[model samples]
Structure formats: structure tokens, C-alpha cells
Target: MHFPVSGVDVFPLIPPAVAFAVSSVTACAGTSGAFLLLPFMVSVLGFTSPAVSPTNFIYNIVAIPGGLARYIREGRMAWPLTWVIILGTLPGVFAGAWIRICYLSDLKAFKLFVGLVLLYLGIRLLYESAGRYLKTREQTIALEKKFQERMRKIKSKTSTHLAAGIPAEAVVKNRLVSLRKIEYDFWGETFSFNTITIFILALVVGLVGGIYGIGGGTIIAPFCVSILGLPVYTVAGAALAGTFLTSIAGVVFYVVLAFTPLGMHNAFSPDWFLGVLFGFGGFWGTYCGACMQKFLPERLIRGVLGILVTILAASYVIQFLII
Candidate 1:
């Protein structure tokens, strides 16, 4: 089948099916799987053009909503964090998009650049996971084990107020939204974060996401847990929501760029058929992934994701040098 805009041939049920599989696994971990999709487009399907970036963003536009919706429904969504990230990232995305159009038209060069970026991001995740996360996880496990022993001894199982003397009603209150700091109660623990710091971080994440055709979730998720010391279970929803909104803006901007009278040789526009095919697959993939996330062990998830990122980053940098 022929796609009208980019003149790419479409394989009925094949691309979307593949997209669904990729998006499903990654989305659960707060990724749109665009990083994976971009390679698939270039190496596998041979959509080896700069247009692939926007096309991947198109996947974010369509495929991200399902996961975002799930986060919202669960009431785990963090609005302040999402807003800060959106505010900072929205502008950077435009700059990054422009860069893609103006300079990085050749797929080979673009791949090298992207590979390096992804490589850094992947390594950063590993560094944090190893340096800080392991200790934190051990502490939590020890606490939980002690708590379980206490519960088994007395059979007294009231809800644990991780924060001493905090009431059940207070936990329901999303009482953590500020420019200076954020303090919220979850699973009986009151957590706080620096709002200004997060805003600055979000902008950087947005810029990278925009250029890479990924939603900022990939960056924001690690930042929340590794840097801010927030629990992943708590921050996941907010990250997903923030990424979803930003991607919406990103895709619209990419589309608008295509329509605008840009002087670049390869102007920005999406391969609608390709994006839609990916989105259709991402729809189911996201749904299944979200469901699976709850059952999967936290460390296992982190390990797998970390490994994938490191491998990709190494491959990207190596390939760039070799070629």
C-alpha cells in the first residue's frame, strides 16, 4: 500500500503490529518507544530520512495518550511536576526541531548525533541506579521486611503512616504543588522535592525529547527517581502526563513547521501513514505494558531498561565512529 505524504509504501498490519509490541513494553516503563522505533524505521523499513524524526514524534502524539490516561485514572499523576516540565520543555522542543530540519538531514549524521545523546542518557540512568538507587532500595527492603515481621507477630495491620501521625485523609490530599518545593503524601510517606530545580531539569529533558522524537518521560522518569529521590511508583503517573502533553505540542509544532514556508531543504512534516501505523500498534502495546508494570519487580524493570539504553548508546557511538 502507498502512503500519500512521504510516498512510503505501507505494509498492512505489519508496521502497526510491530509498533504495538514495541510501544507496549516500553510505555509501561514510561517510554513511547520512539527511540526503538526510529531505528526500526531507518534500518529495518528503510525510512532512512530526516523525516523519520517527525514521523516518530507522530507516534508519540497518538501512542502516548493511552498511558497518560491510565496514569490520570489512577490518581497518581503529579500535576505540578507535569506543568513545570511542560513549561520548560515546550520551547526547547521548537529549537530542537528546527535544528533537525536545518542541519541534520542526513540519516547517518543524525544517527551519530542521536546515538551520542541516547548514549549519555542511558549511561546517566545506569550511574544513578548504581550509585544511589541500590542503597535506597536496600533501605526500603529492610524497612519493609521489619514491618512485615511486626505485622506477622501481632497481626495488627492498620495502614502504615510512613510519615508519623499523618492521617489517612491527608494522604488523599495532593498537597504538594509549589514553585519552591513540592510535598506530597503517598503510601503513608510524605515526600518533598525542589520545584525550581525540577523546572530547570524539565526544560533540558524537553529539548532532548523534542530533538530525539521521544517524549520527555524517558528523561524525566530517571530525574524524578535518581536525582529528586522520589519513589518511582509515585512519580510515574506525573511523568507520563507531562510527556503526553509535551508531545502533543511537539507534534503540532512539527506539523506546523511542514506547512510553514521554511527554507530548509528537507522541511519538517510527518509520514501520516507510518505514524498512524505505529500508533495503532502502540495503543495496545501501551495498554498491556501498563498492566504488566504493576506485576513486574522494580529492580528487574530498571535492570532491563538500563541494559537496553546502554547497549543502544554503545552501539550508536560505536557505529558513528566505525562508519
Candidate 2:
């Protein structure tokens, strides 16, 4: 398939397959996988133009809805948090898009910026993981043992009675929502965060996400979990919702910009055909990943994501230095 806008020629199946693989893992952490996919488009697909950023955003527009629907259906959508994230990130995304088009069009500089952002996120996750391990190792072990026992009982109870494809019951309930704070309950535990703090973080994340075409969830979710001490289960849905909304705005912004003289000079229009191809796979991948997240251990998911981000960040930095 030749996508003239992206100046790439390859099998049509490649993008979707890669997107499916990436989104399956990333969606578990509330990311739409654009952070990883952007790199793939640039390095593997030869999409290095500024237009690539908006193209990546288009993937989020298509890929996020399925996962968002899953989260909402599962009663995991944190509405208050979602609104806060959306409001804060919306303006910043516009600013970031402008910056990307005007200043960061140079691929080298853009890659370096992405490398630094990834490095920061990876290190933050690892540090949080280590801190958690040190502070709560005994408690965590005890909790895991208890959880395993509960799961065993559940399995025994459902072995014959439940249908093979049916998911276990899990729900999120609101405990509180206020101007200063927000709280929710998932399973049995309550998770709380400062609303103001999250809004501030979202603003910064929006800027980075806009420039990177990731829609801020990739950054915000980890920050919520690691820095704000929020549970991943609750954070995942809210992050996805925020990402979805922001991505819609981003795509529209790019489309409008594409007609202007500035847009023509910098290839500001998105490669919609290529993006939709990636989105086709991402849609199913995100749906499956969101559904499976409840079955996986939080620690295991975070550890894997941290490691993957670290490796990708290192590779980007190394490539830049080599070049």
C-alpha cells in the first residue's frame, strides 16, 4: 500500500498488525499506544514529516472509543477525573500543536524531545515501583496471597456454572468528588487524589502529548499511579476518556491547519488512510486489553511497561547520539 501523504510503501496489513500488538499492551495502562506507534511510523514506515504527529493523533481518535466503551461498561469510568483531565489538557494540546508545527518540525529535534520525555516517564515509573517494593513488600506479599486465594475460590465456583467467554464481576464506585479532591472505590479499596494537582499535571502532559501525538494518557496515567498514589484500575478509564476527547480536538486542529500556508510548508495534514489502518487493529487490541486488565496483576503490568519504556527511550537517545 502506498500512502503518498506519508511517502511510504508497504503491505497494508503491517500497520494494523503492529498497532494491534502495541495497543494490546499499552491499553492495559490506559495508553492508546501512539507513543510507541509514533516511533514505528517514523523509523520503520519512513513517516518523518511534521504531519506524522497529527496522523498519530488520528489513531487515537479511532482506537480509543472501543476501550473507552469497555471501561464505561465495566463501571470503571471516573467521570469527575475524566472531566478535569479533559478541561486541563484541551488548551495545552492546542498550544503544543502550534509549537510542533512551528518549532519542532525538524525530525532530529523532535526525536530528541521524545527521547527525553520517554526517559523521564520510564525513570519515574521505575522509581515508583522500587519505592513501592521497599515500603510495602510484606504487605504486598500478604495481599497477593489473599488475592490468589480469592481467585482460586472464584475459579472453583465458576468452573462449570459460568460461560467460557464471560468476564468476572468488577465495578468502580464513586466515594467522593470535590473541588479539591476526588475519590473512588474499586474492588474493596478506596483511591483518592487531589483534583488541583491532577489538573496541573494534565496541563503539562497535554503539551507533551500534543507535540508527541499521544493525547496525554501515556504520561498522565503513570503520573497518577506513581506520583499521585492512585490505583491503576480507576486511572485507566479516566485517562482513556481524556485522551479520546483531546485526540478529537487534535485531529480537527490538524485538518484545519492543513489548508493554511503554514500547513502547506510543513506538511501539517495527517495521513488519514495510514492512521485509520493502524486504528483498525488498535480498536480490537484496546478492547481486548481493557477487558483483560482486571485479570492481570498491577505490579506485573507496571513493571513490563516501565521496562519497555526504558528500552525504547534508550534506543531513541542512542540513535540520536549516533546520528
Candidate 3:
């Protein structure tokens, strides 16, 4: 099928199939898989336009609600964290949309910058994952063992009536919220982060997301996990929620820009049909991923997140060098 706006031809089923596969895995780490999808659209489907960024946002807007709803239903939504991320990222995404059309539409240097940033984030995550494995081996092993025992019980014929995988203890409870700090409880442990720090990070991540069409979740999730000392279980929902809200703002901004003088030289509006197809696949994938997340150990999740980011970073760096 030919998508005139994107000027690409391929099987229509490919988009959703790829989206389903990508989102199912990435959603485990709080990403909507837009980062990976953008590359697929560019390198595989050959949709290289300013509009692609907004189209990426369209995917997030459509795809995120599935996992977001799952997170909420599981009581893992961190309202305070989500609010701060949205507040900080919304403005940055608007600014980024403008920058993408006006300055970065054809800039090779931008790719290097993004590649370096992602490389650093990827290394941070990998280092943190390794550190956790090396330093807390006993505790981590015990936790995983305990979790497996619980799962075994849940899987037994006698306990089949209980809710699957996600234990009631997985719920997130907001303990405190203030300008300087925010705290939450998950599975009997309390996690806290500085509000200003996260706000600033979200702002920067939003700017990049706006330019990249990733909704900032890809960048923010690892930061929350690796830097903020937050658990993957607790941060996943907030990160996805932040991405969803920002993507909505981003899509609207891009559409508005397409009609304005500033966007005259750029195709800022998304190809809605293509985005919808991808979203359709992503919806089910993310929902299933979220359902399975709690059943896996945090270290395994962190390792998966690290590997994905590292591979993406390598691809970007290689593309930069090739360019």
C-alpha cells in the first residue's frame, strides 16, 4: 500500500505487526516504542519527513492508553510524578516541535548530539544494572525467589481464581508531594525523588522527544530507574503517562504549526491512517506487556531496558558516522 503523505509502499499489516512487537517489549520499560518505531519508519518504510515526528506522536497518543489504563487498573499510577513530568515536558515539547521544523529538518549534527545523549543514558542504565547485580546479589536473588514462589502458587489449579501475575502488593501509594520532593510507596518500600530535578530532566527529555517524536518516555524511564533510584515497577506507569500527555500536546502543536507561516517549509502534520494502524497494534502489545511486567524480576527488566537502549544508541551513532 502506498501512503502518499509518507511516500512509502509496503504491506499495511507490517506497521501494526512491527508496532505490536516493539511496544510489547518496550512497554515493559515504560516506553511506547516510538523511538524504535521512528527508525523503522525512516530506514525501513522510508518515511523521512518533518511530519514523521508528529506521526510518531500520533502512535504514542494511540498506543499508550492501553498500558496506561493497565497501570491505573493495577494501582501503579504515580499521580504526583506524572503531573510534574507533564507540566515540565509540555512546554519543552512545543519548543522542540518548532526547532525540528525550523532548524533540525535536515541537520546531520543533530543526530550526533542525540546519539551521544542516548549513549550516555544507555551506559548509565547498563552500569546501574550491573551494579545492582554485583552489589545486591543475595537480596535480589531472594526477592526473585520469593516472587517465583508466589507465581507458582498463583499458577496452581487451586489458586487459579486469583488475579493473574500482578499481586495486590504491587500497588503504588503516594506518600508525600511538595515542590522540592515527592514520595511514593510500592510493595512495602518507599521511593522518593527531588521534584525540581525530575522536572528539569523531563523538560530536556521533552525537547528531544518533540524533535524525535518519542514523547520523552524512552529517555525519562531509564533516568528515573538508574538515576533517581526508583524501582522499575513504580516508575513505569508515570513514565508512560508522561509520554502520553506530552505526545498529545506534541501532535496538536505540529498540526497547528503546519498551517502557520513558521511551518510553511515543513510537512508537520502526521499521516493519520498510518499512525492509526501502528497504534492499533501497539495497543494490544502494551496491554499485554504491562500485564506481564510484575511477574518478572526488576533486574531482568533493567537488563532488557539497558540492552534496548544500548542497541538503539549504537544504531544512531553508526548512522551519524555513515551520514
Candidate 4:
């Protein structure tokens, strides 16, 4: 199928199928996989335009609700963290969108920026996965192991005895929220972090995500898990929620800009049909990832994801410098 808006042509089924494959993996880390998908759209599909950013946002809008709902239904949503991230991210996304159109429209510069961001994130995650100072990574693995054992027990029961959904013991509970700090309890362990620190981090990540078309969750999730000493199970829901809302804001900004004089000069509006196709795949993928998260080892997930991201980052940088 040919999408005129972005001037891309490919098999109709390819977008969703690829999105499904990518989202299924990234969603386990509280991201919608837009970061990975953007690279695919650019390098593989040859969609390098300002509109691509908003198209990515549309995917987040359509795709995130599935996993977000799953997280909420399982009582894992961290309301305080979600709100803080949204508040910090909204403004940054707007700023980043403007910068994307005004300054980073050139394909080479944008790719380089993306390469650097991914490289930093890849290194950060790989460092965390090294298990040196990340008590939270270790804690998350232990907690998830316990949760999975419980899930096995629940599954082993007869249909009549099986629990309706995630057990209450596995749910996340907000213990406290303040300007300076926030605390949450997960499976009897209380995790605390500085609120201002997260807010600042989200703001920066939002800027970078907006430029790269990812909605900040890709960076936020790992930062929360690796640096802030938060459990992955508790952090995933909040990060996804924040990304969803921010993406909505980003799409609005890009759409509104597309209607202005700027639209004539730059492709700011999204290809809705193409985005929806990717969303369809991402919806089921994210849902599946959320459902399967507790069964996977955190160490394995982080190690694999870090390696993949690092390789992709290296490829982009090399392509930029050599090709």
C-alpha cells in the first residue's frame, strides 16, 4: 500500500506485523516501542519527514490504552508517578515539537540526534543490567519471581478456584506523595524516590522523545528502574500512562501546526491510515507483553533489550558517519 501523506509504499500488512513484534518486547519495559519503530519507519520504510513524529504519536494514542488498561485492571497503576510525569512532559513535548520542525528537519541531523539518544539510553541500561548498584533491578527480579510463582499457583487451580485477575497481594499501593518525594509499596516492600528528580528527568526525556517520536516512556522506564530504585512491576504502568497522555498532547500540537502556514513548508500532519495499522498490531502486542511480564526474568529482559538497543544505536551512528 502507498501512503501519500508520508510518501511511503509497502505491503499493507507489514506495518502492523512489525509493530506487533516490536511492541510486544518494548511494552514489557513500559514503552510502546515507538523509539524502535521510528528507526524502522525511517531506515527501512524510507519515511523521513516531520510528519513521521506525529504519526508515531498516533500509534502511541491508539496502542497504549490496551496495555495501560491491563496495568490498571491488575491494580498496578501508580497515580502519583503518572501525574508527575505528565505534568513535566507536556511542556517539554511542545518545545521539542517546535524544535523538530524548526531546527532538526534535516534527515542527517535528526538521525544523528536519535543515534546519540539511543546510545546513551543503551549504555545506561547495559550499565544497570550489570547489577552493580541497582538494588532495584535485583529487587524487581526477586519480586517478579515471587509474583510468577503465585501466578503459577493460581493457574494450577481448577477453573472454579482460579482467581478472577491479579491477586491483591501483587497490586501496587501508593504509600505517600509529596513535592519532595513519593513512596509506593509493592508486595510488602516500600520503595521511595525523590519526586523533583523524576519530574526533571521526565522533562528532559520528554524533549528528547518528542524530537524522536517516542513519548518519553522508553527513557523514563529504565531511569526509574535502574537509578531511582523502583520496581519494574510498579513503574511500568505509570510510565505507559505518562507516555499515552503526552503522546496525545504531541499529536495535537503537530496536527495544529500542520494546519498553519508551517504545514505548507513541512509535513507536520500524520498519515492516519498507516498509523492506525501499526496501532492495531501494537495494541495486541502491548496487551500480550503486559500479560506475560511477570513470567519473564527482569535481568534477562534488560540484558536483551540493552544489547539490541546498543546494536541499533551503533548501526545508526555508523550509517551516518560512513554512509
Candidate 5:
């Protein structure tokens, strides 16, 4: 299939297939897989136009709801954090979109920026993952042992209650929401973060996400976990919700820009058909990933994401050097 806007020739099934595989894994970390998908579109599918950024945002628009729904259903959604992220990111997304359209249209420069951003994310996740294993070994071991014992007790109770057939309620509970801080309880512990700090971070992340077409969830999720000392389980929903909202703004911005003369110069309009195809696969993938996330170890998810992102970043940088 040939997409005239993107000037790429490939099988129609390819995009969704790749999207499904990527989304299923990345959704566990609160990302829509747009960071990885951007590279795939650029390098594998030859979609290097400026419009690719907005098109990727479209994928987030379509793909995120399924995962967000799961998170909300599980009562893991942090309403305060979601609102903060949305408020902070919306303005920055507009600014970032303008910058991308006006300044960073050059493919080489854009690729360099993307490579650097990915490098930063990769390193941060890896460093945090390493710290988890090294600095907190004893604590981690004790926590795991306790968790195992709890699981055993739950299983025994569940078996006994099987005849009653009552479903278990969500494990996450929102404790407090305020302008200065937000707090939530998950499992047996309470996690809190400064609202102002998150807002600031979301603003910066929105700017970067607008440029990269990732909707900011990828960066925000990791930051919430690694820096803010929040659990991945609690942060995932808010991060994805933020990404979805920002992506809607981004796509609208790109569409409006496409009507102007500037947009025509760099193909700022998304290839809607292609983006939707990718989203179709992402929908199911994201839903499944979110459903499975609670069963997986947080450290394992972070480690895998870190390694995968690092490899992709290295490849991009190496390609630039070779060129």
C-alpha cells in the first residue's frame, strides 16, 4: 500500500502489527508506545515528514482510551494527578507544536533532537532500575517475601470465598487531593507527591512530547516513579490520561496548521488513515497490557523498557554518525 502523504510503500498490515506488539509492552509503563512507534514510522516505514509527529499523536488519541478505561475500572486512576498533568501539559503542548512547525522541520535536526531525548529517557530509566536492584537489595527482598506471604493468604481466602462469588474490589484508593499535594494508597502504603512539582514536570514533558509526538506519558510516568517516589501502579493511569488529553490538543493543532501556508511546506497534516490503522491494533494491545500490568513486577517492566529504549536511541545516534 502506498500512502501518498507519507510517500511510503508497504503492506497495510505492517503498521498495526507493529503497533500491537509495541503497545502491548509499553502500555504497562503508561506509554502509548508512540516513542517507539515514531522510530518505526521514520526508519522502517519511511515516514520522516514533520507531519509524522502529529500522526503519531493521533495514534495516542486512539490507543490510550482502552488502557485508560482499564485503569479507571481498576480504580487506579489518580484524578488529582490527571488534572494537574492536563492543566500543565496543555499549554506547553501548544507551544511545542508551534516550535515544531516553525523551527525544527529539518529532518536531520529533528532526528538529532529525538535521539537526544530518547537517550535521556533510556539512561534515566536504566539508572533508576539499577538503583532499585543495588541500593535497595535488602528492602526489596523483604518486600518480596512479604508480598509472597500476602498473596498466599489472599489465595487461601479467595478459595474459601469462591462459593460466595463476590468480586474483589480495587486495591488503589485515593486518600487526599489538594492544590499543594496529592496522596493515594495502594496495597498497604500511602504515596504522596507535590502537585506543583508534577505540574512543572508535566509542562516540560508536554513540550518534549509535542515535538516528539509521544504525548508526554513516556517521560512523565518514569519521572513520577523514579523521582517522585510514586509507585508505577498509581502513576500509570494519570500518565496515560495526560497523554491522551495532550494528544487530542496536538492533533487539533496540526490539523489547523495544515490549513495555513506554513503547513503545506512541511506536511504538517497527519495521514489519518494510516494513524487509525495503527490505533486499531493499539487499542486491543493497550487494553491487554493494562489488564496484565498489576501482575507484573514493576522493576522488571522498567528494566525492559530501559533496555529497549537505549537500543533504539543508540541505533538512531549511530545512523546519524554514519550519515
Candidate 6:
């Protein structure tokens, strides 16, 4: 079947499944598979249009919930962090939608903007992986090791189950004061970090995502884990929750922008049929990714995902400069 808006042929099971796989893997390190898929749509599928951005957002809308549900089931959702992220991200998405339609209609300029954003974010994540975050990950690992030993002792000693009243509460008792410091205690273990700095960082990440039609989790997740010294297990749900709300805002903003007077000659609107088609595949993929995420080691997960994202960033940079 031919998809009209982007002029790409839709194949059964193949396209959506490809989106699902990309999202499922990339999301492990807190990125929406949408970033990588955009290039695929343009270079491979020949679906290069402004509508592609919102269609990418549509993929997020479908793919994220499955993983989020898994996180909820595993008692890992961070409600407080989720709330802060959504509150900040929603308006920015709208502003970004406007900018894309009004000023960034030039694909070349937008490509450069997109390249620079990915380049900066990719380098930051790489730096964190190489050395800056090593000590923090070690400390977190030490604390987690201690916690696991305690859990093993309890499981062996007690027959109490969840119904027997084991409380697993996810609440933010302390406010993040600054980038150099944030502290949270969970399961009788205290974790501290520099949080104030990350808020500024998160904002910049959000803007890049806004411009490029992405969920901030892809960027925020690594910062939370490597730089802020938060556990990926807990942050995954929070980041997913944040991405969910922001995408909702992004879609609405794009739809509204489609009706307004913009620089473009064509009546710009998201191709709903195309978006939904991608979403159908992404939904199942996220479900599987989220479940597997719990079983995977944290270091392996981040290392693999970082390499993939860096490669994608490099591709975009090379394509932009070369073409």
C-alpha cells in the first residue's frame, strides 16, 4: 500500500516492526527510536517532509506505553520526577512546534540545527561514559551491592509477600537543590547527587528534542543515570512518563500549526494514517523492551545504547556536511 503524505510504500509488518525494534533498543538508554527513524524515512523510505516530525512523535505515543506499563508493574515508576519533567517539557514542545513551522522551514538550516544538537548531546553522553561518570557509577554500584545483599537476607528470612504488607513507595521527599547535589533514599539506602546542574541540562535537551521531534527521555535518561548518579531502573519509568506528556503536547501543537499561516505553501499537517501505522508496531516493541530492561545489566544497557546513538549522530553530521 502507498502512504500518500510521505509518498512511501507501506509494507505489512516490516515498517512498523522496524520502528518497534529501533525504539525498543534505543529506549533502553532513554532515547526514543524516532531520532534514528527520521533518517530512515528520508534516505531509505523517501518520506522527507515536515510531516515526518509529527509522525515520529506518533511513534513515541504508541511505543512508550508498553515499557511504561512494565515499569509500573515492577514498582520502578518515579512519580515525582515524572511530574517535574512533564511540567517543564509541555510548553517547550509547543514553542518548538511554532519555530519549526515559522522560521525553520528551510531544511538545510534545520538540518544544521538538528546536527549541532545531536552532536553536543552525543559528546556529553560519550564523555560521561568514558570517565566522568565512572566514579559515580562505582559509588552507586557499591550502594546497590549493599542493598542487594540486604534484600537477599530478607527474602531468605521472611515469608512476607506484597499482600502481607511490604511497602514500596516512590516519592520525592527532598527537593533537588543544585546540579552539584540531589539526595534520595530508597529501600533504606540513601543516594545523593548534584541535581541543580541537571535541570539546566534537561532544559537544553528538551529544546533539542522539541526542535527535532523527539522525546526528552532519550537525552535526559543518560544525564540522570551517568551525571546525576540516579539508577536507570528507577529513572526509566520517570523518563518514559515525561516523554509521554511532552509528545501529546507536541502533536497538538503541530496540528494547530498546520492550520495557521506559516511560511510553507502546502497545508502542513501530520499524516495520521502513517503515524498510526508506525505506532501499531511501536506499542508491542516497547512492551518487550521494558520487560527485558529489568533483566539486563545497567552498564551493558547504557554502553550499547550510547554507541548506537553516537553512530546515528555521526551519520546525521556526515550526511549534512557531505550532502
Q: Please give the distance, in angstroms, between residue 116's alpha carbon in candidate 2 and its true position after superposition.
A: 1.1
Better of 3 and 5 by TM-score: 5
> Residue-wise lDDT of candidate 2 within 34-80, one digit each (tens)?
89999999999889998898899889988988888998988878788
CA deviation > 4 Å runs, candidate 5: 131-147, 150-170
- How would you order the candidates by lDDT, starting with the best? 4, 2, 5, 3, 1, 6
Writing each residue's lDDT as its tens digit, candidate 4 over 153-218 gives 777875443332335557878889999989888877788889898899899988988888888877
Report lDDT per candidate.
0.69, 0.83, 0.81, 0.85, 0.82, 0.68
* Predicted model with the maximum lDDT: 4
lDDT value, candidate 1, whole model: 0.69
> Model 1 over residues 1-323: C-alpha lDDT tens digits?
77666666767788888888887777666777777878778767777766777788778777877776765655556667777777877887778777777777777788887788777667766665563565765533543344445444443455543221211232223676766888876655666788888888887878787777776667788777666666555566667666677777777887777776772445467787788888878877876766565444445556667778788878877887898
Please identify which of the two predictions, 1 or 3, would achieve the higher lDDT against the true structure: 3
Q: Considering only N, C-alpha and C atoms within 3 Å, which residue pairs clash in candidate 1?
A: 20-281, 24-285, 162-188
Off by over 4 Å in 6: 143-183, 192-200
Q: Spell out the clash pairs found in candidate 4.
A: none
Candidate 3 Cα errors over 4 Å, as ranges: 132-149, 152-166
- Model 5 C-alpha lDDT per residue in residues 1-323, reported as the tens digit of each score: 99987888889998888889999998888888999999999888889889899889889989889999999888878788889999989988988888887888877878888888899889877876785553554434443454556556767878642121111353567888888888876656677889899999889988988888888878888888777767676778889999999999999999998898886566888989899989988988899888878666667678899999999898888877778
Q: What is the TM-score of each candidate against the true structure?
A: 0.85, 0.92, 0.90, 0.92, 0.91, 0.82
lDDT of 3 at 74: 84
Query: What's the lDDT for residue 159 in model 6?
Result: 50
Off by over 4 Å in 1: 128-132, 137-173
Superposed on all Cα atoms, model 4 deviates from the true structure by an RMSD in Å of 3.1
- Could you list the CA RMSD of all candidates, in the order they appear? 5.3, 2.9, 2.9, 3.1, 3.7, 5.0
- Relative to the true structure, candidate 2 has a C-alpha RMSD (angstroms) of 2.9
